[model samples]
Target chain A: MNKQSLVYTVIFTFIVSFVFVTLLALANDGTKERVQLNQELNRQRAILNALNIDYNGPQDVQDKFQNVEQIERDGVTLYRTTVDGETIYAKEFTGSGLWGLIRGYLAVTANMDRTIGIEILSHNETPGLGGRIDEPWFKQQLRNEKIVDGTIRVDGAGDGDTNHDNGQIDAITGASRTSDAMRTILSRELSTFQQILGGNS
Target chain B: MSSPGQILKENLWTNNPIFMQVLGICSALAVTNLLTNTMIMTIGVTFVTAMSNLTVSLLKGLIPRKVRMIVQTLIIAFYVIIVDILLRAYLPDISRALGPYVGLIITNCIIMGRAEAFAQSNPPLISMWDGATSGFGYMAVLLVIAFFRELLGFGTLFGIQVLPDAFVPWTIMVTAPSAFFFLGIIIWIGKSIMNREGAPA
Candidate 1:
């Protein structure tokens, strides 16, 4: 009942802290497996979506992902899928954006000469501006575009003259930094992919 | 002391958190761009507020005067983490969609306000009701704003196309600035209605 007593405050604080921490630890333990599974599933789904593969649910994802093989070639992780006797590859890309790291999947054709598709997995870009990079319209620009000499250009100037044959894409209007970041990421990742796949092909 | 029904009515309409008290507008503006995100955020906020209120009320008798705020904050944070974990485990898609906003629920003023003003003095059951009704009030306003934003911005409600093909989506409504105008208009309309109802006959 002594509101001013230091002992009471200390004891109360300790008890509350102890109880809540224990509760959180227990909840975290309970959800650990499920959370990890969900995260893994999400990553797989992003990879599949980037490859333009159709999947409906977790079961479908697993079934379709069965065709994809994960390989660590020259310290770079690549996902390879063979459909109708042609191989397609996807690799995770992480690069600096305007605010933080932008992570995504880059799917390349069998010869590593063209991009099959691109899917942004996560980014800390400012919403509504740089964040528009995650929108389908922006990503669609990277789909089926040729990757020339392990480089891609993002046209920052509002010129609609981006050459698809030369691996050039238009940047989101208000997200020049993010677009530039994406360009840097794709260039860097393409070199890595070429190195990993160079000896095999 | 007010009756339980009066408390519910007061929180839901007369003293609504968003339109009346304006207690938690941060999440409102951030997540109301999409109806789905708003709904998920509303549920998460409601869970944290109700559970935190109940926990705070139960411990009110033993809480010291100087440390009550700290204790309340601990409870709120604990519940918020639980919500985050559960969402990651069971509703990973929504969890990822919400990003850091779920964690931000711990800092929402409405939960702390209820804990200090109502839960610290009321019974656990009543405090829970008050917390839940406050959340519901906040959610109602957010959903209304989201309805207009998503409908006009994305030309969809709950991700379904309701607007005709001839309708052009408003680009501004998909951004945070759009929520400001929508929320302001709703607050204006809500206040005029409340004022009329409160006027002398």
Candidate 2:
């Protein structure tokens, strides 16, 4: 192809491709708000689930979680709350796991030392193993655990016994690394939450 | 002229992407732990691939020979973004389960490979058919893998228990690496079947 023809082809291709992509973006604009709302609602649901609070859908979610207030620190969103008699604060934390990042919410009781519950908001672990952490059976073990001493461990199977020396949650079988990563992340996040909620408490 | 039945046989089974060509293995490995995630991921890939193929083929005549690949990539990325946005809005849970893997579909070799090899040379309608059919082929393999994965890994399929109380679950079947093994086994079985049919190159 000649230089002039090649230039024309390039220009034409650029224009067409640009126009097509722009149109797609424009079409997506209509659904963007719904997407944002869905994401926010899903996050609220996960946090509520971590706290053992359940609602069917969006309207149910709104009815139960009517009051949401932001907790800011140094211009950053440290945590947020939904007031439903008991104030539940959702704190975010991230850490390196066996494969990739493990990000989650650790919801605390009003006193801050007791864990209301925990939920994995995002993770990149091996599926079927680390991914099992997303299951409720694994998460439910966190409820009512004292965050001050709660330590996640993988040891030989024992009777479901509570040891107060450290808050103990039965680790998921075959997902030791991922469970350990969660423990490390939650401990670190709870300490920070304590610092943030210290004055108020 | 080749009949539609012949083409369907070729695309759907004889030359299946996941079982035979082994394209798009990333999603197969990542999302097959749960039947629901596997289903949604299949639909998302089908939408992105078909739309990308259609757009690419439509512009093939106008695309510069030198920059055809770049143009194809732009078209594919546009479709992927559209699918990603829609999933985030409508299927928040599955989207969250998919994580960055949905956006990573932009780099899914199946979409790109189809555009460069088939879509760029075919008419838009044919390319769309090819993309959708190839996605089905891909889903066929993933579902087979997921069937076993969800069954042995969780003692269930689609969260419904199929195993009697005596059957112990296999933990390894649910992880991403297990998909590698499953894909290998599926490919081996497929190759053997093709070889019995005179090994058409």
Candidate 3:
């Protein structure tokens, strides 16, 4: 009955793993619905913000989102809504950031000529530096931004306040690498977005 | 066995994980830009540390010597996943803000270090107390670091602007390297104070 015996070791490891993992599974099951609901709300919120739709809170976000239609085609999901007689298409995008993957919603007009806005759903960038991508000012810059030369530029150099023009946005100070990553992410996503939605135009 | 007060004092000052052993600095830096994020992340770490310690202590007698590390790891990971699920469900925004850092708790050495150093030898309840105090020690330093980073970098505390409109933020304060400066200063102050008390930890 030695605790160090190989047979005991194998049985002990299996039991311990089973117990801990089962506990985790139970916790996961208990919260799965709530988590999924949170995710759905968050996604809806991001789409709303990117399209410059105002929502008060959770209930309002849910209410406002009802008008928006969900479209799944060409292996992608797009949220379609009309704002002020303008047809807007919003889609979730995943791209590389400075530290890890950055996921967000990119909303553009029907003609795909201008951005309705963009809201970062999640990112692993430094909280104060690169993470500023989610701040009011940064996302504001993307609102009604003009997409030039078939891409949006996230590399404005401390430019004087020229938001929504020249197709350039300022890189967050002290976060140039992350800014560069955003530039790449935006341009690439914009192209893919065009390819996916272009046929409809 | 050390009294609860002694354990608390030792962990908070003399044997602080951040200031003394300097463990768990990566998360300390990553989540410290904002006080709220720091608070939540630290609390999550505290919960993980305490629960894992209690479980490890309870299981120590039965754990196989050759597989102890893996068992301890599974225990830690189990708790981390639960924390993550709870955050995602109940506090979705904060969960998104935290990003992968919650999952990264599995890699934080403080949990494993406590399991091997204190939990393996201590009784279950006190070992849990020891782990919780160790987390508080880590939390104390991180909160201090977050205070300075958020204030100087954003001219705000907890998202409320305290600095005037004319005040310019120290951009570096919001970046990763700035964490090193703040953490070092805190550690230096802590050590000097400890030395003055005729006890250098």
Candidate 4:
């Protein structure tokens, strides 16, 4: 607490803080670009996954992504990522789940009757239970699932093997709430998209 | 000079932040569900921690003792915000994938603890090394947990096909609770090693 001690402490503190902040600024400069690029590509990939548009290379993916334009139909925003002048995929989205938000994209065929794929863009819920919605197995169920006749099915069930037009996808075990949430969100979004498409036509 | 072996021993075994002091548990539990995400997060935490420690150590002298904590928080927040922006702009997918967890890194006790405990006392050079080492310690534990999660839970590594098609995922390993269990075991193993090495038990 003496004057000399105080000055020493003050000087030491000043030097330390200055050096720390300066070094941080420098390090930040180094890794900034790589982190940013990685994140952007990840998002684009998710968007593509939502659209079910496959690509062999980054350039091919980017080109396909560019062709697909995002359109807002009614209240839902759909990301349309196309390839070869045809509407390869359309993403209809909605959110719901236990204890947090779950945002899902239903990737539908151009005609909108069948699902090419689906992906969860974001979700926050109980980690073990509600969060399993992002698993690939859970996600895979939506692939090739149809949206016909107002009802969705999983495992190609209840249609006597002839119900190709019926929408269905297998639900993850113990994730019933999350599965139901996805179903509800997708159904609502698709219904809205149908209405919007109707209005536009 | 201290041998590189000593540094490795210290970081990988003794003085581990996650297993020993149990710092950064919030993120440890969150991202450990996926090896790829865990690796990305670990690297992010490592960069932030090492740079922040170096910065704090450098400024340890000038910062008024009364305001030192606030100063540290400000510096940490600034780096985190920068990280968040970079993630948003560049690694939009992982950024989106990481969701709130990235921002939550600001609150991770491990980063703040190192800035206060080690950085405030050490020289910048040593502080940088310590920070990086400790961050790796945290990463090491989480990655082990994530390895199990991705392997058993998803039957993959870094999203690559690892398990044969005949393999069925455990399903439970990919959740947050699994992280908790694995982290507990890691902490136990780390502490036992430290104790066996004659470090303070």
Candidate 5:
């Protein structure tokens, strides 16, 4: 009965921890299914975004995704979508950022020479710095750019030219490392995708 | 002994956790770039603080003094994990937007500070109210900062474009340093108001 006694302390700790852990376990169990669904939905949405498709909600995402064919070739899962008899391919990519992993969907045109668009699914880069990669302005630069000779050149901010014609996109002002990493990841992954697509590029 | 109303006022204004006491500033700075993010973070912190405080106060009588801190931390962490799970399950978009900041709520000082200073001695109801009010106070300050940040930095409020098309966004306001300035100015203004009302600055 003594509050200061070791037995009482041990019992109190055990009871408190047991109660909370049980509550947490119940909560985790309750939300596990929905959480998985949400993740799947986000992945689908990202793929849709990379294809430059307009989607409203979960139903829209599902309906749009229905038109896309999933093909796994050489350890890479490619999402192929056909619109007006023209085909587009999107592949998931993960690469090291300045702080952590940067993940996204990279979609290219039927010829595999020009990009359709890119949608960053998730990233752990520094917010407001490297994180700006997810911003419309930054990602817009990559869209419709030509991947020349299997390489994409990224120019630093304030350089002589900020044009995307030569496959160069301007880097974020304070996130040069992340910009460089993104460029490298795109080039490397693009080459890999080209090989998987029978060296079309 | 203070009444519940008094406790609420003290924590919410006179001894505000963010502006007046300046206890928890890390998350305030990190997530205040967007009003939606700040709102989600505020709700999460409030839930954790109030629940942890209530739990700690209920067990205050039986807790061994030597292990009180460890017990408090465990309780806070337990509640935080529950919040994280719920967010991931129900509000996947906000959860993903928050990233690890939700998990980092365990390290937020306001929760631990209230548990140690108020919850350890107060009744459960009072402790819960105190914790919730403290969190609300923190939220109020952060929302003010986020208003300016989102407005000027992104030309949006709660992701809605409220600014006119001619408005130019301030890129600096989107970064972390802008939060520092905004928070500093807010604290200064709050202190000045308090001093004018004959309270210690």
Candidate 6:
């Protein structure tokens, strides 16, 4: 039982790990369902955000989300909400970012020519650089931008077109890779979004 | 063995992890933008630090010298995950706002530092007391910083309107840069007081 012995080290390490890990495993299991519900509620909040729905808190998020109808068309899941008689469709989208995967919801008008809004659900980009995608101004810029076949471009302000009136939304400064990734995610998802609504409607 | 009163004073003031040891600064800067968030975040840190220190102290004699670091890490991570899961379930909004910082608590040096310096040599109860007080030390500074940041940045205290109508929010205070000024000032004031006390023990 010498503490310095290699065998003791191995046994002691195993025992210590087992004790702490078992505690963690129990905690994880106990809260697994509640955590998943919270995560789902977060996605629900993002959907509401994309649709420009105002919610005061998690309770309101739950209540407001009640009006949202989940629809699956051709394997595409869309969150449907009617706001002031206009039908907005929100669908989850994912793409590669500079550091890791980017996940979010993209809401659009039924016609799919303009985005209602976009809410980044998760990302792994560097903080203050690509991570600015989650900033209010950055995401706010995506609101009501015209898009056809998801052809929206996220490039430099004056690279090709500076006009946000068109489908060109300004990319984040110093985050070209992440911006390009956003473009790829939206353009690809939007076209498919168009199809999802186009077929269902 | 240190008296409980001395441990509390040292951790809360003289030997504070944040002020004296200068540990756990990253979270101090990141979460202090809002008082409510800072409170919850620091409380979580406190709980994890206390429990981890207790467990580490209790198992110190049984732990292998060669694998002690790994054991301490497992112990800390276990408590952090429990705190994270609890937050996700109970305070989902704050949990989302705090985001990766909660999980990042596992990397906070204060926990490991306590486990190594105090917990390894101290009895379980005192180790836990030292750990908790250290967290309070960290919390006291962060709360002060957060109070100013939230007040000036948003004209609010704990999300309530505190400033008068004429008050104009300082936009810079809400950003990351604001934390530096507050942290530097706090550190300067703390060190000055310590210097006036005449000598480092």
lDDT of candidate 5 over B93-201, digit per residue (tens)? 8998998899999999999999999999999998999889888888888899999999998889999999998897787898889989998998899899999999977
Candidate 1 C-alpha error for residue A186, in Å: 2.3
Candidate 3, chain B, TM-score (2 decimals): 0.98
lDDT of 3 by residue, B36-82 (tens): 89999999999999999999999999988899999999999999999
Q: Give candidate 1 regions above 4 Å deviation.
A: A1-4, A148-153, A156-168, B199-201
lDDT of 5 at B57: 97
Best by lDDT: 3
What tens-digit string does per-residue lDDT give for candidate 6 at B37-110? 99999999999999999999998988878888898999899889889888888888888789889999999999
- Tell me the lDDT of model 4 at B182: 84
> What do the candidate models score in CA lDDT, each in turn?
0.87, 0.75, 0.88, 0.72, 0.87, 0.86
Which candidate would rank higher by lDDT, 3 or 4? 3
lDDT of 4 by residue, A119-172 (tens): 776787655456666766667666667777644653422212233445666555
Preferred candidate (TM-score higher): 3 or 4:
3
Candidate 6 residue lDDT tens string, A3-101: 899988887778767877787788889888988888888888999999889999789999999999998879878898888888889988889999998
TM per prediction: 0.92, 0.83, 0.87, 0.75, 0.92, 0.78
C-alpha positional error of residue A85 in candidate 4 after TM-score superposition, expressed in Å:
10
Where in model 4 is the C-alpha error above 4 Å?
Answer: A1-52, A65-91, A107-119, A125-144, A153-164, A197-201, B1-11, B194-199
Which ten residues in a row are the worst by lDDT in model 5 chain B?
B165-174
Superior by TM-score: candidate 5 or candidate 6: 5
lDDT of 6 at B165: 70
* DockQ of predictions, in order shown: 0.65, 0.57, 0.75, 0.21, 0.69, 0.43
Best by DockQ: 3
